[model samples]
Target: MSNSSNVTKQFSAFYLENRLYGIEVGRVQEVVRSMLMTPIPLAPDYVCGLINLRGQVATAIGLRQLFGFHSEIPQDLINIVCKVDGMLISFQVDEIGDVIEVSESEFEPTPQTISEDIRKFMQGVYKVSNSLMSAIDVDNIIKFLNNKLK
Candidate 1:
């Protein structure tokens, strides 16, 4: 028996300094614990330099830098890596959260009053339980890198 009307995509939520952030699980290649970052000279503040991720050079990006936040990043944080535009890009997040699934109708528009930094990175908001997890826009993040390189 095949049901013709039951389909839903799953999402993984991560906690970046207590705020809920969601990303499509399919986009994620792997998640690993925080590792020592080798700083690169003349690199933008956001680029924490490259890390030797199992023989692969993964560019570590500080989420804090992307947001222009002045707060200090914790000493212990992990890098979430994924293949972005054929290059391995790793994001520095506070910690990995749970994976949740919901109907397509659950996606909601982001609040207009959200901060410019947050707004720029998120596609929309996913209301999960008591908090709203901003869905990370993969394309937007890639666009940011392009703009920076220009």
Candidate 2:
């Protein structure tokens, strides 16, 4: 079983504040620099707004606000566009990192020390060289947001 779980997968890493997080590279559509966002009135606080990505309207989400962080979003943001349930959603992150290939053996369950809000959306944690990278579950995130919107 352990040997079966040792398959390697690539993840696109990004930063929220100082914390590192990652999503499966296959789920990521593209990463774009800061772009003009059109605010959606009556939307959840975490929903930053909408961005036109190559003529497609993508819903932009404020990753910090979604994680219950009270700090203001930085002026320069990097948006990681991911396809969840056939829909494209953009996650605004503080900084974009590299695409790291990690083996399943290096993945561990999320620790209890992590805050409740963040823990809910994480699939697991990967033991990187210098720091732990929390794996973000895009499906769960989309489900949660859909529930909130309903």
Candidate 3:
């Protein structure tokens, strides 16, 4: 067996509906406070809209809507702008958590019990103290959105 799975990585954590999730810290550009988003006509429900980040337009995604969560997204949510496939995409999360350093040995494949909708976007889960942190695959998310938009 290869030891590559034992590499350690840093993750930028966030919360949604009290559940913890994270993305690779290297992919995260910045986290910004909630701002007005201009809605796109005929856009998918998960597409929250677009935001002007500095001078660049970033597409904001409502993670709650994308994850099939029924709870309404709070207005005071934070935007985690991530670079995926060389494009800036913003994920609106309930709240920003901390930067967690996790070992690859602690990573586990997404559980079969997890909802299929969410499982698809997950890279895996890391066992954290008292909770599990789902690793979000930003690339997969972008691909999912692309397919949905087609």
Encode model 1's per-residue lDDT on 38-112: one tens digit a residue: 898888888988888889888888887887777778888778888887888888888888888755566778788
Q: Which runs of model 1 end up more than 4 angstroms from their true locations?
A: 1-7
For each candidate in turn, the TM-score is 0.89, 0.95, 0.95
Q: Write candidate 3's Cα lDDT for 8-81 as tens digits.
A: 99999999999999999999999999998999999989998999988889999999999999976687999999
Best-to-worst ranking by lDDT: 3, 2, 1
Global lDDT of each model? 0.80, 0.92, 0.94
Model 2 lDDT tens row, 31-102: 999899999999989999999988889999998999999887799999999977667799999999999989
Separate clash counts for every candidate: 0, 0, 0
In TM-score terms, candidate 1 sits at: 0.89
Off by over 4 Å in 2: none
* Candidate 2, residue 139: lDDT: 84
RMSD score of candidate 2 (Å): 1.3
